[model samples]
Target: MSDHDPRPDASALPWSCEAEQSVLGALLVDNAAYDRAADLLRRQDFFDTRHGDIWDAISRLVLAMKPADVVTVFDALPEAKREEIGGLAYLGQLAACVPSAANLRRYAEIVRERAMQRALMQTADEALEVARGEGSFEEKSDRIGSLFATVRETGQRSKPLFVGDLMAQRVDHYNALAQGTVTPGISTGIPGLDEALGGGMWPGKVIVLAARPGVGKTSLAQQILLHGAEAGHTGLLLSQEMERTELVDRAVANLGSIGYSRLLNGKLSNPEWQRLGPAVDRLAALPFAIDDQAALTLHDIRTKAFAIKGLRLLAIDYVQLCAAPKGAPRNHTRNDVLTEISRGIKALAKDLGLTVLLLSQLNRDVEKRSSPEPTLADLRESGAIEQDADVIAFLWRVREYESHRLIACSLPKNRQAKPGAKLGLDFEGHYQRWRDSAEKVGHTGSVGGSADLGFN
Candidate 1:
């Protein structure tokens, strides 16, 4: 192709030199435009090397609370690099080229679009390489998914809202609350827990449900998922430790009020069998799904979660069982991996605007103590779980038969309500369910302490 040809050569990559120039010029002409452009455009978004350098210099000056005019930006550039960007004269020309700063956002967007196109081209090349390599199908799929996730994240870049714009949304929310039309969050189906949470589990929150082994952490998580589904919310249960059939069996036991041992051993009476039919039917009708993928990485969970339409809540059976991303830092200890996993789950909750309830195992320290009640410090593997969680609840049950059925659900950390709130729950081991204890039941009372078998 000729040098002046309108058609691009096959080897030529996507770029927008003019758009990059206009963006930098706009910032220089009206320094206020830097705030708007900075959100949409990064230095690397510029196609030309010189333009990239100029944008980088402008960014440093603007971020330092200094003016980013042509003179200031030029002066900020290193002496060795000034000559490489066509000297100070080119900087002046760039500022003069833009007619007005009114279209700064548009120019920045164009630059960003070109950058994304270039990134996609690079990603395609990498995918081709992966396809040609000798890797497992799952490995290739994960690599491709990671690439797409990166691009999706890049496209979600947005400017910060003005206080006035935020105030408008706040006013609307206030009106909804006043009119009693607002559904603040998804309910856990337990009135006491719901009340303690101010309403229920909110979107974009990470809730850690932890306890010593055999304390019903998984059961509680399943209960929340089932209840959320019954409340007209779609939910996903990612069981890294349990089989799909096992989870279904637990659901059946909870729904039918049958003994779990009897259900497992096929020792149910005819009446119990009859109860199971309707319970299974009810579960099938609800919008709940389960995945029993072993050693699942965070990316796998995120990909599977995104495929479920209208998913409002996601429950991971246990956090420690989850595998870290492939090729994670070799120097990272087990605790570091767990910390990364916690942060990843937290980020996923915020990104998808859904609630993530993570079941976790408590450290042995809780059991060694006289009380045997778990705390935020007792979360296994990493303390990062406590920091990342919006709410941290510990399920404490005395192992004796008499007290085994009583679970003291304590909230050690609650971002939405007062912390250290404790709820007395009657644990029906046979039914695999929990009910709020009666008002007369003390926090440390046994399951039989309450005459009420239903939640408030």
Candidate 2:
């Protein structure tokens, strides 16, 4: 056998040299074509390095309000680089390659598709290297996950919409609203919250539920998830702080109306036992999934969350526990990592067009105040969390009173409604459930008289 391996065929690599030439030619022929092709193509999308450079130069000239053509581009390039890129003649050749600028958009699409394929090839090569390296299993796995995320992101690239196109979409939305055919947003199962939010959680929004420990942030999130599931929306709850079993226990207690302590201690009475079976069955029937991966990185979460088909909402139970991806700068402070996590979650929500509810711990500063209610400023570690969140609500219950059954929920920041809105919820610690306080009157007179027990 020959010592040398056969070279891969050039044609086998995903690329459209002709399309790249066409796009460049169209831009050179008519600088105005830049506007049409700007959104669809980027300089890096060109397979040919020289073509990418020429495109970059052309873009610079056009964006600067100067004319762009073969001569102008050639003149714009550095003298030392011209000969390396086949001198000025290559520029003239590219301009002559296209018949007209009419199909510039089509050419751009072809270039983008080829670029995406090339990106996948590159990612695959890097992943194979990782697999063959001496890295640990987790390292290799994380590397692969990061590569996959990059591929997914590359596939999602698209041109920005023009003003006319955006206005058209806006008109359609208004018409839908006028016809009473569109549900404004997802409901949180709290009537007061729904009214305050003008519907409920909306797609492409980040809602932060911040509170001190023992104030029921997770409880409130579970309530919202249960409500969403009941409304036929699928949700993924990523719990870094709690085990999946614990989550299920809470859900069971909340749904079964069984005492949380009884479930935890396995001291259930016969009546509670009777309710537990059906409650477990009901919880199993909901379209809610939980991942209790400890110390999950942002990339890990994104990979798993994106895989869930029809995922409408994502809940991160206490974001501070999540780890930044491997290879993050060692010099990054804790606050920097938290900020990155916060922005990453926010971006994920927008990119996926889903709602993200992030539970967060309040700072001790809130406890030092005479009024211990949490505020947006009380978001622990990073101010970016407050800036990135579209809605920030604080969960506050009286700390001094053990018998107070009401939890105070105050919205310090509401993008869709007036801020400083307050709502009271009846907290049933036994069941790990929160209900509108108004619902308490009817339950208080029940034969069991269990609802009268103040558990906060």
Candidate 3:
């Protein structure tokens, strides 16, 4: 092939040179190394075999395009083969492999990278121009938004499927849904709660536990962490209110069967101390990690979640505390903030493919009058929580603020479960636990004392 002409197979390039050039040029202009280029190239199928080999040769040649380096590379090749192919055709190998569908992917990827870099550079330039008072805020935002839109829109649509044809596929993907196999493996932290939640939280489900504050929302969340850890699940508990030590104390008191006051006051009998020591050790050993940052943004949480391995269930202590992404500036009203919070939580649930249980505080309006019952409209701040949440649960204990009275845990709004079906639970102050009252009443109260949340 002539110096100006691309080889015959150039059209078959699996990857886009424009993309590679865009990314490489962008990175190079920023003085970034070519290691990522190697990575980008390796993701292609043909690159795994032939194109990868030829691409490396092309990269080496391009980097050392200087005449002296070219001479050295040529000299290294065998004399007879060198004479037969010559330097030009040796360089033409890249062009020859370019048209192959396999190589096309690498070329396209490289071109995309180059385009991105160019666009980014242009963006920086435009930003500089904006800083120089060349454009208004509206103009800059629109321009930046449009440029990103173009680049995002231009990205490769799909790669060839590795799984072959759909008709010939044999793997039973729906076995989990059909045979009821639980793959993600999450425990709801309460044995009874797990049973109620269809054998604990399934992957990629959003479980919104909405309740008025001081009604055992946080305690229930802690219970989930305990149950999950007990079941050998690695739990990441992101709490907004409590500090790490406070969480540890609560976990020990709630799940470890240690008295909260005793643990805090450092009071225990010798035998009790022996039991608590190993219990504390076991609690420490459980695959649990907690972040108690007071006001973390959703982006920050998403970043941290990405770092966690074997992550099963994600429990956000409360959703409202989370800040929105860098953009979408929070509006003046808490309603606006709630809108952002709901969107963030839902996005996180879908993105991470894990069950998310978000603790939500209810409006005090539900408590002002007699017969306190929560409505879906009572969800604080925004309706996005109700709209996006898969399941919404409210916590109501009869004796929390009242004397011995029967309180109903009602689900006025259930996305999946039957609406108006109340899950009856009894509250005990001494043990601080919520127990199922339905089975007990049917059994004629023969089960001794009723079950409680065992909260302190």
Which segments of model 1 are wrong by more than 4 Å? 1-12, 16-18, 21-31, 53-99, 134-165, 256-278, 329-331, 398-404, 439-456
Candidate 3: global Cα-lDDT? 0.57
Model 1, residue 25: what's the lDDT?
Answer: 83
Task: List lDDT for all candidates, in order.
Answer: 0.81, 0.81, 0.57
- What TM-score, over all chains together, does every model reach? 0.81, 0.82, 0.62
Give the CA lDDT, 0 to 100, for residue 408 in model 1: 78
Worst 10 residues of 2 by lDDT: 440-449
List, residue by residue over 1-456, the lDDT tens digit for candidate 2: 112111254467888777888898899998988988887678788767777888889999999999998778888888876876676677788788787899999999899999888888888999999999987888788889878787877677566667987998889888997898886899998888887776799999999998877677887898899889988999999988878998899999888988887788899999999999999999999999999888878887788788899899899988888887777788999889888888888889989898999999888897676675666778888899999999998876642224335667778799978887877777777778777765222111111122334242
Residues 85-171, candidate 3: write the lDDT tens digits: 345454344334333233333544555464455556666676676556655664555455545445544443444545567535444
lDDT of 1: 0.81
lDDT of 1 by residue, 1-456 (tens): 012222254249887667877888888898877777877777667767678888899889888999988788989998988987877788888889888899988888888998898888888888888878987887787788788889878878656687998998999998997898886788898889898787899999998888876667788888889998988889999998879998898999898887787898999988898898899999999999999999888788889889999889999988989886766678978888888788888988988899999988887887666665666778888889999999998887632243336677888899978998887776777788877875322244222233322211
Please identify which of the two predictions, 2 or 3, would achieve the higher lDDT against the true structure.
2
Candidate scoring better on TM-score of 1 and 3 = 1
Instruction: Judge candidate 2 at residue 219 and give its lDDT.
Output: 76
What candidate 2 gets wrong by more than 4 Å, as runs, is: 1-9, 25-31, 53-99, 147-164, 262-278, 399-404, 439-456
Give the top-scoring candidate (TM-score): 2
How far residue 193's Cα lies from its native spot in candidate 2, in Å, is: 1.3
For model 3, state the Cα shift of residue 103 in Å.
5.8
